[model samples]
Target: MSQAAPGKSHREGISLIELTEMFPDEASATAWFEQMVWPKGKRHCPRCGCTETRKASATSGLPYYCSGCKRAFSVRIGTALERSKVPLRKWVFAIYLEMTSLKGVSSMKLHRDLKVTQKTAWFMLHRIREAWSTESASLFNGPVEVDEMYVGGRRKNMSNAKRRELKDTGRGAVGKVAVVGAKDRATKQVKAKVVESTDRATLHGFVADAAAPGATVYTDEAVAYEGMPFPHETVKHSVSEYVRDMAHTNGIESLWSMFKRAYNGTYHHLSEKHLNRYIAEYAGKHNLRNFDTINQMAAVAAGMVGKRLMYRDLIA
Candidate 1:
């Protein structure tokens, strides 16, 4: 309900009053989602990809019927919202909160805000994150900054047995997962992934996939980045050299810093099995940070198409 601070010139987001006025009810929210998902003003069949459809009977939960598929479907049928019982109004508000919150919104907070169970809120967040799994078609043009970071609970916070087990294997990054990312200096967009290891092939392959041909790359003095195909430069962090004539990986490191803040401050624990999804969510949010709040929310909705994450599969 709070408004922006005094004397701020730029518009970052809308007021709660505006949000409520825009989506005052489930019907309004559903219409807005329909507009974003089916911009042509007509619903298409997800199964048969047919545009010929009719309204369903009032008693049926499905809102549309496709003659080609002979099936009843709702706007949620093929997207991350498919089979979800939560109201569209709540989904709209959830996407709004997720995009606006700088650190991130926790499921517990979302549960209180939406009046839903904590378990349901947790699943809802994961599904919403599922909607952020958009992959960029074009590669980043240089000079791109690349870096890798380890994500997990700190070593001192681990249990005695776990600490000993990790010590037996190795010291740093022994039990943590490695996440490598890149930031395009030209477009200011970012890309990242959670990898099994930070080996030469893994790191180099990630940079190669993300950077365009003939683009210049900047990285730390990690030996894995020594033989990049593109024009490569490194800053020797081991000797406290961070930035040396536009050769620093600071841009990508800043992206990792934001992700770590969200990790440590909001979602305290991120399992390795689901780490990639979380990384994708952060990268997507970072990539779209400059857009208007409503457009960012609409992008999440648009990306929801052809994507669905079931609770069973998520847990499995």
Candidate 2:
């Protein structure tokens, strides 16, 4: 995005005056980030954790030189935006656009809204998606539902010849990626992973890892998951039965609808390589749909440090 006039703020859920007060100028934003990122007074070198450091004379204003490691770094040094020449304001605006849009703001849309070239907009959004790729250790704390769905192609839509060629659903799912989902019903939180296969060994293992032991897990009567070992229950779909005394895969299934809608409505296409980051964005947003938008923005921005993504890598 073209840098905005000074004093503008893109933060959501707060008044213009409030956000403006928070980030009145470039200096203030820098200070705000420094405090937020290293509140404990230890600026561990991004390249190496060296306790002793001083500002590098080669750079102006607040860059640190780690004496122990002979490295210079700043708050953005190891973040997704580390080497990016785009201003911090664009990063803030880009994240605001990503978090606030339900379906998603396309790169084209972000290009229009942020007044940046499409290439810059695309890279920026992908980097923001990187932050959304959370390694949250928060296991599903309540009743978790696990299921798998074929994400691509309707058998009815494919050409008969092409469908015939791709009919074998074995040895790497040659056409479609097997997706596993776990949804916590009470919290309405969902987590999904792009898995290699949907075999019993693959799907069940992912479910157990994401959800705690003894959790009441529910799913459909997929023969692939007949003998699940964790307080398991199933609702057979073949007998015209979808639910029995509140047993169903509806929660995780709803997540699939939302995920597909976002991909179709905004992103238009998704590759198997980038699907997990996209899933992380949707699941994180869905899990906290009830919370204030600014809090979600903070959570995303707070994760920007200590990780890096090159513009080339995003495309590759």
Candidate 3:
């Protein structure tokens, strides 16, 4: 990635015109991707990890041939972009648009902007999300805020049959997917997942995995978070006590607020089956919020390696 200061606007990095000038042709975009995927000017065969390679036939779409694997491969192989027909330049543009947009880039908007089919645009967005999907190896050191949110359509908007089926389920958060999240105050990075339940075991397991030992954990007075292994504190939100001393879930709650805004205002509806991918996208982007737009784009490109999201598998 480029060595640049972190900022949101184009002033911190390349503007649209600058980006266009930087990648005027397919070859230029390909070189940039190669730089990100294989930094330090070292390119290896993705198949066999061999350093020996040579130019492929002119008729072959693949640019290089791996002598060890005896196969031709491009940078797209073994990545979320594998088997994609979209041009690399358009992919770069899509990435820039995806990163720059705080909420997210919708398939319709992306299709319109890139002159691609809506279905292709939708798949492209999901592929980018898959590329950003990652698990932080290090645990949060201290003052981690934990919270859960329900994502789904409103009861009023649901069909009568669906409403009737969920009538006995419960009132608030019924017929909705529960997502638990933790935000590290020090790093300002968040990790979250679409959980099957918000029970004690589930919530506790999440906190235990996310927070390091002896780390301070903050949460609302939820029964699930009653017994935490780490040094824990609670703010009684039920009685309108949000903050007491250094205890508050405001950070995680704010993350939920932003996610909900994107959910409602941008995508409008996120299917439960793929809700986790959307969560990963939001959380990943949130973690990279401070980086320059170009750097953020490079990060996504770097993450593309070792990930492959086939259209068949995605729909399945």
How many clashes in each candidate? 0, 0, 0
The pairs that clash in candidate 3 are none
Q: Considering lDDT, where higher is better, how would the candidates rank from best to worst?
A: 3, 1, 2
TM-score of the candidate numbered 1? 0.93
Candidate 1: list runs displaced more than 4 Å.
1-12, 159-171
Query: Of the candidates shown, which would achieve the greatest lDDT relative to the real structure?
Result: 3
User: Which sections of candidate 2 miss by over 4 Å?
Assistant: 1-12, 15-24, 40-42, 51-62, 154-157, 163-174
> Across residues 191-213, which tens digit of lDDT does each residue of candidate 2 receive?
88788888888877887788887
In Å, residue 139's CA in model 1 sits off its true spot by 0.8
Clashing pairs in 1: none
Q: Give the per-residue lDDT digits (tens) of candidate 1, residues 1-316.
A: 1232232245367877799999999999999889887887977998789999999887776889898988898889889999899999999999999998878899999999999999999999999998767678689988999999999868788889988887787757877899999999998889998898999999988988999988999988889888788999889999999999989988888878888899989999988998999899989988777676787888899889899898999999
Q: What is the C-alpha RMSD of each candidate to the true structure, in Å?
A: 3.8, 6.1, 2.1
Rank candidates, TM-score, best first.
3, 1, 2
Better structure of 2 and 3 per TM-score:
3
